[model samples]
Target chain A: MSTDLSVPVFTNQSEEELGGKWGMVIDQDLCTGCQACVAACSMENNIPFVGETDAAYGRSIQWIRIERFWQGSFPEVKMTPYQPMMCQQCHNAPCEPVCPVFASVHSASEDINLQVYNRCVGTRYCANNCPYQVRVFNWRDYADARVRPELVTLQNQLNPDVTVRRRGVMEKCTFCIQRIRHTEDVAKSEGREIRDGEVVPACAQACPADAIIFGRIDDPNSRVSQAGLASRGYHQLEELNLLPRVTYLKGESNNGSNG
Target chain B: MIKKFFDALNQPLGRVGLLIAALVVLSGAVWGIAQAQKPPEQPIQFPHKLHVGLGIQCLYCHPGALRGPSPGLPTESKCWGCHQQLQRFADPTTPWPTELQKLRDYVQQGKPIQWIPVAQVPDFVHFVHRPHIAAGLNCETCHGDVSKMTVYENPQVINMGWCLNCHRAKTEDNSQNNPTNDPAVSAMLAEKRTKLTDCSTCHY
Candidate 1:
C-alpha cells in the first residue's frame, strides 16, 4: 500500500528462520515428466483448465509443467524433459520490481512469493517480467460448473485454503501455504516446534519417484538446504542473479546414449 | 441545513413522508431476518441427525475429509449397507420412507443424489479441512454447532477479513515455537522482522 505503487521485495532473517526460505530441490535425473505433478498440483490448488486449444497456444494455466528440450531431431532425436518450472521466489526478483500494482510481493515470514489476486488488475507486467514463464493467466472461467460439467462433483474437492481463481486473473504456485499454516497450527497446539520436512506441497507428496524435496533452506542442516547447496544444484537463469528458491539437480547420463 | 428543512415542510406533506419512511425501514429489517433464516431447498433432504446420531461420524460419510480437498458424501451402496432390509417394512408411520426410494433409484441407475452444500468459502481462500483437523482445531471453531440443527445453515460468513483476522492474531503469540527458545534462536529472531506478507504463501 505504498504511494509509489511498486511491489516491495523483502527478505527478513527472522522470518527466514521461522518460516524459512522454503526451497524445492527437484532431481531431474529421477523425473520422467509423466505430468503427474502437473495433475496433482491442479487438483490440490483448484487450478482451472484452459482446454486443449488454449493449451496449444501456450495459454494453459499449469502451475508446474515439464519443460522439454530437444537435443536432436527425428529418429536421431535426443529429447529430454529438463524440469518442472515455477516461480523461483527470487531474492532480487525482476517480476517484483516491475509490477506497478504490487500484486506480486514477498514477505519476511513467507519464503514463497505471493500474488494478491484482489489487488491484481490483470496488467500481466509481472508475467512479462518473469523469466521462468510460470505465471498463468485465466483467460476464461473454465473451472466452473458451466464450462466443465465433469468437474462439477470434483470441484468441491478443491483446497479451501487456496482460492479458486476466476477468469482474467493470474495465478501460480505458492508452495501450498495453506498446508504450511495448518502444520504450524498443529505444531503450536501440541506445544512443539514445527520440525523440518513436516510440511510438503501436494506435488512433492504425490511425486511417484519422490524427486521433489521441500524444506527450509535457511537451516543448513535441513535436507532442502543441503540439496540446494549441492554442486550439481543450479537455478534457471542463475546468471541473471534471480537467486530462486527452486533448485534443480543435473539429469543423469548413461552408456545408452554414447554406446 | 435550514434550506433543506424548509424544502421538506414546503411540500406540506412532511408528516406523511416520515410515516412512509418508517414503514419501509421496519419491513426491510423483517425481510432481512427472514432471508437469513431461510435454508435453500435441496434435491435431497440428507438426514444429518439420523446418520450422525447413529454413531456414524462425519468422517464416515465424508471419507475423503482427511486426505482430499473435498469430503465425499455417502453413496447409495453405503446407505444400502443398512437400508436394504429396512425397505421391506410395511409400517405406515415411518417419517421418511421415500429416503429408501431415492436410494433404490440411485443404486439401480447409478444416478447421483444432488445434495446441497451448506458451507461455502470465497474463491480466493486456500483452506483445507485435513490440516485444520490434524491441527486439533475443533469442528465448532468456525463451523458453529451442527449437531443441534436439523437443517444446515450458513453459520459463518467466511470472508477474507475473517480469515486474515485469525492469521493476524496467530502471529502475536509464539506459543507454537519450542518451549525453550535457544539463545541463538532468540538472537536471530531479535535481529530481523519476520516477513508475514509474502504473496506466494496464500496465492499458490
Candidate 2:
C-alpha cells in the first residue's frame, strides 16, 4: 500500500472536524495581482474607507493588500510578483495573547484567529504584536456623518453580516466568519456536515485566477491539503513560527527573473 | 448659590460625572413617563384583540415570520380584502367605521399602509424572525401576549441580552423539535444550537 506523509491536516469549529483544522493554500504563480480579492474582501467585510488624505497618511483600511517586492538594482530592475498579504490566522497567534479584552482569541472550533469588534478596546497591542502587519486600527468612525455624503452613500452597500466598526477599534481578516457561520447554519439545518469545498471565504471566491484556495486541511482529499502537500508549499517567516493557516506556493518565475 | 452651581457645572471633569448621573436619572424618568403614557398613535386603529379573537393566526397578517427575516406588517390589500365587503352595516345603510373609512380612502388612493412598527430594534442589530419561529416559539415569546392588547405597545424590551437568553437556553431545552422529517431541518437544529452564542448570529 502506498502512503503520503506530506498531507497537512488541521481541525476546528464543526462537529465533523473531530480532528480538523481550517487552513488556506495560495498559488502565487497563477495570481495576476489584479486585486479582485482586495476589492471583494473590503466589500464583503464592510471595511470602511479612510479617504485620500488619511490613506496618504498611511491609514488605508484595506484588509487584504498586495505587497509588491521590487527585485534587483537600477538597470535590471523587475517587479518580483505581488504577494497578497492578509491576516495569517495563525495557530500560535501572536495577537491573541496580547489583547487585553480577549477580543483577539484563537477560535477553538474553526482553528482561525478572530477579532471581535465589540470586545476590542483599541489598545493597539494586537497590531504591534502581529509579525505579518495585517491587523489595522479603526482611526475614525468612517460609516457615520464624519465621511463625505457621497462616501456615506457608498457605505450603504456594506455587507449586512459584518459589523460596520465604530471608531477606536482594531480589526483584521476573520476568514469571513459570517460566511462560515451562515454555511454551517444552512448545513446543520439539513442534517449533514460541512463539505470539504463548501466553505470558501470572500477572497478565495473572488480570485479569478483560482489562486487562493481555502478549506479544511484536516481532510486529506481537500484542495487546500493537496496544495499544501505539493512541492512548492512553504510558510512565510517560518522561523517566527506563527503557524499561520495561510500557506503560499512558490510561483514559477517568468523570463528568468528572481524566483 | 447660582454662581457656585454654574461653576460646578462648568468644571469639565466634575461636570461629566454629574451630567451623566443627571442624564441617566432624567432619561430614566422620561422613559418611565413615556411607557406610562398611552400607546403610539397609528394611522389606523389595528386592535389585536378584535383580530386575534376572530381566530386569525398571527402569520396570516404578519406572514414574514416563517418566510423572511421580519414579521412584516400586512399589505394594504390584505386589509382592503376584508373591508371592501364590509360595506353592509347592522343598519344596512350605515357607512363604514370611521377608521375603516380612512383605510378605504387610502386603498382607493392606491396608497400603502405605512404601519408604525411597535418593536423597533436598533440599526446595529440584524434581528431575524425565522429561526425564532422555526424554534416553535409563539408570537408571544418575544412580543408579549398581543391577543390581550387593545392598543398595541411594546410589552417587552428587546435588547441583546433578551435575545441571548433564548438563544442560550433553547439548546438545553430542545423542546421545539421540528415535526418535519426533512434532513435539512434536523441538521439546522443540530448546528444552530452552538451558533446562538456567536456574536455574528445577531450583530452581523
Among these predicted structures, which one has the highest lDDT?
Answer: 2
TM-scores, one per candidate: 0.60, 0.77
For candidate 2, lDDT tens digit of each residue in A1-259? 2566575465444433343477888887778999999999999998877888889999899889988777679989987657788988877789987898988876655667778777889999999998989999989888776555657577669787778888888989888877776776667567699998899999999999999998888888988898888767777787776677788887455423323
All-Cα superposition RMSD per candidate: 8.4, 8.1
Candidate 2 chain B: worst-modelled 10 consecutive residues by lDDT: B171-180
Question: Which docking category, incorrect, acceptable, medium or high, applies to candidate 1?
Answer: acceptable
lDDT of 2 at B128: 68
- Candidate whose DockQ is highest: 1
For residues B57-125, what per-residue lDDT tens digits would candidate 1 score against the true structure?
777777766764566766777876776667545454755467666776787898777776767654564
lDDT of 2 by residue, B2-87 (tens): 99888988899768979899999999999999875546688888878999898889898889887546788988899878766763
Q: Which window of ten consecutive residues has the lowest lDDT sum in model 1 chain B? A: B189-198
> How do the residues A69-186 of candidate 1 rate in per-residue lDDT, one tens digit apiece?
7666687877664578877778667777677787787655665577888777788888998888888898877778887786688776876667778777887787877777778766
TM-score on B-chain, cand. 1: 0.66
Separate DockQ for every predicted complex:
0.34, 0.26
